[model samples]
Target: MSTAVATRSGARRIRLDVRLLVLALVMAGAVGYLMYTGLQGTAASYFVTVSELQARASEVDGRRVRVGGDVVTGSIVRGGPGEPIHFRIGDGTSELEVVYSGVLPDIFAEGRHVIVEGLYRNGQPVQADSVLTQCPSRFEAAPTASSS
Candidate 1:
């Protein structure tokens, strides 16, 4: 009788250990799922320059992005109200037109460094939600015209 009771107690202990292991596995799985969802929600790709953008345009469209390039010499066009500014950004190989509605930075100008953030539709230029320009210094001197 004593031997039988000892065996029963040992079996009960083994069953309890198995239940605890299952609970641990369930908890770990739940934590892993939450982590995966959180990472997916915040995933995004970084933007590139005009050349890089053109190369990856198909894959980048409809996704959030930030692109930067030099402003083209003769592509700036200012509009009114809803359409504040329009300009083309270039990286030699390709160019992209950007439309910005909000107030522009003081340094925003032609032939300057610009970074525009937005989405592209079809083959047309991407409309920008934000535009940043790198302007030249005011202390810089302009070249004087030479008389012939």
Candidate 2:
């Protein structure tokens, strides 16, 4: 009788340990899944200059990127609403052609710095899905002292 009771207790302990391990694994999986989804939803992109983008064009071909540069003068060709807007952005040393089709911001214009987000293919213009213009830090001019 003593041997039978000892065997039964040991079996129960083993079953309980197995159940606890399975529960822990399930909880870990749930936490991992939540983290992955949370990060994917709020992923942020960093800016790359036109020169940097061109230098690495081969490696980043067809990949999504955000390119920042000043819009080249006389390079903005605005189309009617809902049409494609063509422009070139240059980072002093290099230029990247861009094409965007959407409602442009009110402040968007030639000569303003812009950040374009889209797919880039080597030897081709960037097909931009979004264009964001950089606003100037000084909205008002500094007050000057009048000569006495």
Every candidate's lDDT: 0.83, 0.92
**What's the CA error at residue 87 for candidate 2, in Å?**
2.0
Q: Give per-residue CA lDDT, model 2, range 1-148, as digits (tens).
A: 9999999999999999999999999999999999999887666656889999999999999899899999999999989877899999998999999999977788888889999999999999999999999887677788899999
User: Candidate 1, 48: how far from true, in Å?
Assistant: 1.0
Q: So what's the TM-score on candidate 1? A: 0.60
Q: Which residue pairs in model 2 clash with each other? A: none
Q: Candidates' TM-scores?
A: 0.60, 0.69
Q: Mind giving the per-residue lDDT tens digits that candidate 1 earns over 1-148? A: 9999999999999999999999999999999999999887666334488888777878987776788888899898988677668889998778888877888888887788888988776487787888877667788999899999
Q: For candidate 1, what is the lDDT?
A: 0.83
